[model samples]
Target: MKRRIQINIAGRVQGVGFRPTVYRHATAAGLAGFVTNTPAGVLVEAEGEDAALAAFSALLKAQPPVQARVETFAVSDVPLRGDTAFVIAPSQGSGDLLIGIPPDLAMCSDCARDIRDTANRRHGYAFTNCTCCGPRYTIVRALPYDRAQTSMAAFTLCPACQQEYTSPADRRFDAQPNACAACGPALRLLDKQNMPVPDVADPLAAAVDLLRQGRVLALKSLGGYHLCCDATDAAAIRRLRERKHRPTKPFAVMFPSLEQIRAHCEVSPEEEAALADPSAPIVILRRRADSALPAEISPDTHDLGAFLPYTPLHLLLLDRTGPLIMTSGNQSEEPLAVDESELTQLLGTFADFALVHNRPIVRRCDDSVLKLSGGRRILIRRARGFVPGAIPLPMRGPPVLALGGDLKNVFALTRQQQAILSPHIGNLAEFASYSFLKTAVADLARLLQIKPEIVAHDLHPDYASTQFAKEFPAHTHIAVQHHHAHIVAGMVEHNLRGPVLGIALDGMGYGTDGTLWGGEVLLADLCTFHRVAHFKAARLPGGDEATRHPVRTAWSQLVAEFGDEAEAVAAEFLPALTEIERGTLRTMIQQGVRSPWTTSAGRLFDAVAALLGFQGEVTFEGEAAIHLQMLAATAPLPPYPFELVRQRDPWVISFGPTLRAIVQDLRAGTPPAAIAGRFHRTVAAALVETCAALRMRYARHEVVLTGGVMQNDFLLDLLHTGLQARGFKVHSHALVPPNDGGIALGQAAVALAKFFT
Candidate 1:
């Protein structure tokens, strides 16, 4: 019997050679079919013998293109049209936009081979790419992702390249960015003043030479520009850091191969997998003690952020230069430079020369970052290879746009049950970052063709995202509490219908009571939450200034614990402060002037780090805490004492006893490493105790751990282990970051849940 069937597939189906894959499969099965890209997804109509059609359908479901992720597939029987040949049809953009745009993929093995083969047409080509791998999200400008809707539209394909793109059997079939050296984006070398460098025949070679000569080169990459220099040269690294004004923060290193990465860092199976994954993120790996890399690459930490080349340009450069320090091409907290004008305008002072290209970047994306904990990769920064793809929501709702928090800003747009999060937009405290946020929102919304009915934002009124949400055209607006969003984001990732015991720990968020909260325990579901327990608050003597200087927070903590004796203790342990400065801080704490109380886990870590002799202001957001986590050595130290006070409805977990014990240890000459280890254990134990009690009272066993503080692998590992041992089902972030980068997803989820209710 002859039968026909039509199949509709969604999720990462566009711009990933899905139509070609379908054509090949249909032809191989001796079935007549036509495949085309639609706004909703890939649509295939096949007609043949029933057995052949069944086998073809099975193959399509079982095997998709390596870069394709099939989230939903539907097949239905259709009347036979007597089609006798398989054909790839042109894309139609009429239906609903339900398909996910493929993220930027790393260079595939075949493309790598092509670039390395001297006889290949693409040999030594910096922009060599096929359907398997190349720029996707960054170059894409509109839906029904054809070449005309992309940045590649400006570049005309040469005759030979056009043949490969038109051939259904070729690997480059329908590859939008497919090009050869004959007609493709070419690289150019420019001086610091944005003038073309004379007599540079090979820009890649010139860029490599400049890097080898200890000069900083701002090289345009797949998503944006990166400041590059030799990683092994301490002086060069120092010079680059000085020019960029990034003194102590770590710089990611790009190596040529996995073998070289293994030489400098301990690559576990999981870390190795992440480095080689298609996303090609910078994976945080443990540094080998005997390795000889320059200390300036990563100062004050035992971990190194490393990644392999994801683009042919990067591969060629790394092959010639070995390892280069690859950092974002922008001043400290500004937006990434995407085009030549922006690059020269922002990074002109830092780069000695610029390696640019003619190809435009439709959207700017930074490299994603990941760290391994409990043998799983946790996202530190989600961008590039992992974005523009939708995260499936547990329930469907009206369209919503979520503007995330100010720090580590990322926004989300929800269509039906899929939430599309924007790539990392950096700190909104900077005007440039805020502008980038707005631009990103507009671009992503247009690309997805969604005008949100509801707008969601953080409760913090002063956040740029919140302010934007206020002005955005939407039918409804909802303000989600920060900690509640953190916990709910984890819940959404795990698809949990919560009312779970939620542990939200981070730097600080505007609390419901008009205070700042971080160390909080809440019983939360998607729409609502109840704050059940929290860490006792401590005064931040100078408000925002106290966040920059850990010593101020430490002194305030001491005053809260030791009273009048706090000044003597400060004089002994905190010699970094002068007597006059100490008295002024004391008066601020006593008189309740500009001081605001916070129960932040990050502030707690900062205070302990300061007490352990880390003086002065932090160079980065979590510098002191990261250093403190690194200082903690493995030991079975007992936890410090803490008191759980049930003096009110919402109980307080007081660390006053723990502070006194830490002081006593400091007085007893205990090693800072041991104290740090003990402090971590104490925090883990207290949280476990709180959750255990809450589970008994509320009858909820599912516990979620989230927030910026959860980025600390040491603390996360302890909490994961302890909670599981106590018979609680624990969940944490893996796909999206635990930091504020994932806040938009939670905000979207909460808004949708509330609207549906």
Candidate 2:
């Protein structure tokens, strides 16, 4: 056995106090070594017996930073180069390879208790951080995490603080965000007119008073500024809605704790973990049987999105009672406030009371959304406390950046085999969202320090991001078809670098052929994609008017597929629509009056929900799809009535079989629950068969499912389990949402492929 051992620890080692912890552990074990921060990670050149080295290695990994993730360690035999003492060296760059950056974490329980304790020296400290926990991604600047390269640089260490920072045995050792009342970012409460409030002894008390009085307050947070109010009070929620000009979109809630959440809504073990994660993202939970939250929260739904505290400030704010309505601090459709000028310009009149802070937000990151399904935490929106760090693409490619689609926009930068997706901005149509996107794109590019050879964007000419991509005159701008990007993303995630069939389904995307496309099967390659099959063209009778009001889709489906008699017979589908709307829809379908053609699965979901008398008005995007998936959870195993037929030499799935089944169910007056469940199961079964047939010819080729439709658990589980059982490898998203939320990853991936091509 080797007498001496050496090891290189990598992944998220910098910006986190990795080396100090290493020294503490090594010295405690009585081993002579030196730990130095490398560009890649930390290198511990230790002189010890093999047995002792083995034990030290275990101890190193077992007690890593709660915020920092240790991806790997390379341990090997070393010649005796015995050092007198274990020490932490200064920071070093990790060559060309991108370094891992840890996400911001919630304040540790110890630090939290100290902050709440009035007698403690660090009482009410907002930036109280130890090596084990507190701001990582949020406060960091450059990596190889040192005091000088973070926001904490402004605060010189007091003598006591210096001692604690130097002592490895102490928790604050090398904690970059470490500070006390003597030194740190200060807070100032402001009135609506941009003037600081005069000597308010208790800002929290004032904030609570505003909340209780049904007044809106804009509070700056770890991620960004948020507009908060009492969610339980109807009048307050109504006032917030009017002030923000967001009539119906559901707002996220922050409760005191898990027990408080359980009191309001029913949460599964999976959902509880997601809510309690360091990210503290908005998690969708089922409403309890005795649900009584304000209707304004989930105006047209049965579930509520909830989150726990992720910051010391959040904990202090939640110390009192009522559920707080914490929504992004921006006007309707705009990105959350990040910049000082923007905050003053947009929110000056929107909030009655404004809680401001001096710390600058280098970049804006929205709170990530998550759902726990099948006992695994699935990221729906990879933002806020979880972004910018590169995730290795399963396949290798060159560096490039892709500006994502128009809605729920996120951008991505790819280098080597890793793709770093930028945080969620917002809908790009709004000027604030567009500006945030612009800043974030530049930020990631600067952070990675990569000059891109190519820029990728959606095929749509109207998307603001696409327009921005064209402005890069020197860079090669590749306009990828919207659906093709979706296809390539799925394939790239699975490392399926070769040509394969792709099924891209969603609400709408600009097709390569210049018509709206959604439900499509395409023959896709890295260079190009061909439309091989698609859902039968259906008339969107009211054009864009049909989206917010889905009953039009239901009416059109009836008239186009089952004739006028079916339209008259289907009263349940027409509930949301008035008599005039019903008459107008009938006329539009019969005459093909101003109808836009679409094959969107999202629209189909809306139609299905309308037919079953589920949700009438959609407060948010995918509202219908989300509720439909919930209904589908009650569905059982049954054969779907769908036929794979060759239409004009291309294989297409005929919804005719499924539509007929639904019509028959309507005639028999089948319960909406049974009908909705059967529809979900049927679609899943059809997809499995489609992939299975294709795989038979290719002899073991895999299937990768993507798009917003794949966000449906009922459909996803069906395809995953059913396809796997039939001996085919199935790939779906866990890190990113399958929806347009992850469009940037696909865009970046495709852009990288073009560089190699």
lDDT of each: 0.90, 0.75
Candidate 1 lands at a TM-score of 0.95
Candidate 2, residues 409-477, lDDT tens digits: the string is 888887877788888878888887898788777776776676777788999998898999999653588
TM-score on alpha carbons, each prediction: 0.95, 0.92
For each of the candidates, the C-alpha root-mean-square deviation to the true structure, in angstroms, is 2.5, 3.0
Index of the highest-TM-score prediction:
1
Worst 10 residues of 1 by lDDT: 92-101
What pairs collide in candidate 1?
none
